[model samples]
Target: MSKVILITGASRGFGKIWAEAFLKRGDRVVATGRNIEALQGLSDQFGDQVLPVQLDVNDRQACVEAVNRAKEHFGRIDVLINNAGYGLFGAVEETSEQEARSQMETNFFGVLWVTQAVLPIMRAQKAGHIIQVSSYLGLIAAPVLGIYNASKFAVEGLTETLALEVKAFGINVSLVEPNGYATDWSGESAFQAKPMEIYGPVKDAFQKAVSVPGFFGQPAATAEAIIKLVDAPHPPLRLLLGSFAYPSVRKVYEERLASFEEWKAVSEAAHGSN
Candidate 1:
């Protein structure tokens, strides 16, 4: 069956690749971004199968309207890729409150708003998939990406809870936790806070880390994984892409378990024996 797939931030990066992948597989695509002009090429290439929409996910009303438009145009939305988010790079204190809030507005609330808008249609249809494009930062943390980590962490929580809540309606929600990928994410898409001399070392470390050869892989493989996930009979609650994410997240869990075990005596000592 040709599914109707709507992807935010679809003008470029992983979003664009996913849109192209779905279109190639015979699915109708609703590609949206803040700049719809950038999506013209997809519309030109795919014709009637592509619907370009200008959407700013930060705006709740705009999200609703965009989903409504997609529903009106395609009759049903089978998959929604909440891929509209960016990185806010800097230390916790270095990032201003306004900058931090803006980061949350787009990365966290944006996903929530779009999901809320799409839920009703999915519920009515009794079938749908919501893919939250989170980050390994969501599971763990990075030094200079505290704000970005916080945002994706919130997404992790939101999608996890949403998965359980919407399962009854046959609506599957999954988080796509990809590590560093060759995207505009840390490049043009990222917002760097005003630098402080105190954080120079951290900034330098981040720069060095990113500059490492083969640090980031292309997005084509990631897009293919997502397509396979969508086509699966039962997709997992969380799908980690890229070679780095698997071990990175596994290490986090292993360390977390070890810490818990190490503190088990103290944790149990606080409670009275039953």
Candidate 2:
């Protein structure tokens, strides 16, 4: 059976890759992006299998309309991939108020709006899947990506709760956390803060970390995993893409566990018998 999948940020990056992957497999896709022109190729190639809609995920009303359009076009939405988000590269102190809010608007709130729009339809159908394209930074953190991390962290928490809440409705929620990919995410698609000399060392270290060989994985390699995830009867709540993600997240958790053990007495004392 061909499934109807709605994907945001289908103009480029993993979004476009996954959209084409689905279409090639005979799945219908409602491919959306801020620049519909960038998505025209998909429509040209896949014809009616792809619906390229112009959408700025930051707009709540537009998100609702997009969902409605998908339902009207395909009769039902079987999957939704919330891949419409950009990275904000800047240290905490270097980030401006507008930058932080804009990041949240598009990254966090955008996911929220689109998910909200589709929930009713999925609930009515009693089966659906929602995949949130988060980042490995959502599980951990980095120097210059503080705001970006926060946005993804918010999505992680939101999707986790959503999974639990919608389980009875047969709605599956998964967070796709990729460590680093050879995508335009960190290039033209990213927002950079005004550089400050005080944070030069921090920026340099961050750059060095990402510059290591094999740090970034190929974007196309993720299609198989995504297909398997969507086809699974019981999909995982969190799926980490790339070889770097699991080991990196494991190390972070181990460190966290050690710190928690170290602070066990303090943590217990703070409870005050409550």
The candidate scoring highest on TM-score is 2
Query: For residues 62-106, could you state the per-residue lDDT of candidate 2 as single tens digits?
Result: 999999999999999999999999999998999999999999999
List model 1 lDDT by residue over 113-177, tens digit each. Answer: 99999999999999999999999889999899998999999999999999989999999988999
Worst 10 residues of 1 by lDDT: 209-218
- The list of candidate 2 runs beyond 4 A from truth reads none
Q: Give stretches of model 1 more than 4 Å off.
A: none
Q: Evaluate model 2: give its lDDT.
A: 0.95
User: How big is the positional error of residue 231 in model 1, measured in Å on the Cα after superposition?
Assistant: 0.3
lDDT of 1 at 151: 93
RMSD of 2: 0.8
lDDT of 1 at 83: 96
Pairs of colliding residues, candidate 1: none
